[model samples]
Target chain A: MDTLEQDIKILIIEVLNLEDISGEDIASDMPLFGEGLGLDSIDALELGIAMKKTYGIELEAGDGRIREHFRNVLSLAALVRHQGKGSLTHTP
Target chain B: MISWDVPIVRWVQWPGIGAAELGFIEPLLRRRLSSLARGALHVANACAQGCPSATFVFASRHGELTRTVELLRSLAHDEELSPTLFSLSVLNAAAGIFSIARGDRAPATAIAAGVESFGYGLLEAHLRARKSPAKPLVYVYADAPAPDPIGPQSGDPQAVFALGLLIQGDASSRLHTAFRPGTMVGTPATLQANACLRALERGSADWTSDRHHWCWNLR
Candidate 1:
């Protein structure tokens, strides 16, 4: 898929330590939390941290809208791309 | 089945400053790791596994508060705390890591009971063993004394230790132990895990050298 989707999938694999999972195994439109990836609340927190480190987007505490943003690999990729353009920083 | 009276396995000691260097307790502390990166590497060698009916117990005093304090300090300074350090600061990281590594899906509990951590951990282990007469329950206790600035006066510094017990169901493998509730004995200069280990190693019915309260009878 696109660069953003690829990057998000990579982050998911790394943070969750899902040893048997690969980027190719994750469908772009498949749900991440329940049926597809089985990720839990802890994984979500880890994903939040990874998003901050990689995309420089600090998720606000009251940002309940992130639930829709993290729906699936495609949704996460689109959100990262949209946020990456405005807030992304390259720390040397 | 494993016995409690006679020593089934000798406990090995892992001495280090933080989770990365310390043995068996790494997984629980992985999410909260900060300055204690060196400690996690210490106990990187050991592993344990068993049945689903078995329960797991882990005990530690002080836990990984060193890293927790460091993270808090960094936050107060408005600095970015290291993600690795922040992840491994919890006390249960060791048990979680061990469970993940061994692929042993048994329910596990992590306990921090101050100075009585080791004794309480052992008590829990005994109870689990009693409940599951066929499966072996694993018990692990590990700790690193609080660092300087906090000062050693709070407790013993430079003391890093871990102990593992596999309690089996077979009567032949069981060790006879006597338990007395509400007994406050002297504090042992050595680590608590070591004191329990020393008693088990010698097959002694009673041990009081360390400020610990323990008695056993081996057939």
Candidate 2:
């Protein structure tokens, strides 16, 4: 996996509290919701917030392609790279 | 005086003062449990063993107050709050998590009655058991001192503990509980739980508060 993809995987694991799984366990292209990681709507919102905090990526709630951007680690990394900025506020 | 012969079928407590053993819960869901929920579920699970389903009465004087305080602090700082934290920062969080984990559809009630949480929780369980004499009733009380500002003046016991009791409406052995108006006195929920435990082990325990007087006697 590329550096950005690896980072996104780590971020997902940390933010979602996937204690039993590691980055190696989550396939870069696997679906993150419903089947692969079994994450739900709460995890989606949490992951979105974490992304905003870490990568300064502001996701519009009404964005039709939001699901596509959060589809998997690779897609999340692409979103971060597309935004190309770090957090502007305290990352607490 | 309203009283009933409430029988305690089983009892358990969590970790003396440390983390509770929650191997039954999947790490995915368990990761969201706060320490208070962890301990409450730990004892509740143990007491509910062998029973297919049971009514649950979960009580805490300061249920998730610590987490609620943290969330409020985050909001005050204009920081983006964690969705997970906000979700679990409720008095009924543990009871909800327990029902989901067990896949049991039995009704669960959460109570926070100031210093009388333990007493009123058992009373609530007794009332529920009387209504449905067939189903088992589990009364679980867990509390930890809340962080400064919100709970310090409440006189909560400094220790953290969870107590579970399996209540049966009719049994060979019985516990007699009574309540009446009395002078108010502040007592910590932990001490109230301990007093109930002592009553079960020995013979009786009683407390006096400005609003009420509560007593328990194993008969």
Judged by lDDT, which candidate is best?
Answer: 2
Name the top TM-score candidate.
2
Q: What is the C-alpha DockQ of each candidate? A: 0.08, 0.79
State TM-scores per candidate: 0.55, 0.90
Q: Is the docking of candidate 2 incorrect, acceptable, medium or high quality?
A: medium
lDDT of 1 by residue, B34-149 (tens): 32223322332332332444456777777777777778887988866655446667887766665665556767888887666776677777777667656656677777777645
Best by DockQ: 2
lDDT of each: 0.60, 0.82
Q: Is the docking of candidate 1 incorrect, acceptable, medium or high quality?
A: incorrect
Alpha-carbon error at A62 in model 1, in Å?
A: 9.8
Provide the clashing-pair count of each candidate structure.
51, 5
C-alpha RMSD over true interface residues, model 2? 1.0
Error of 2 at B199 (Å): 1.3
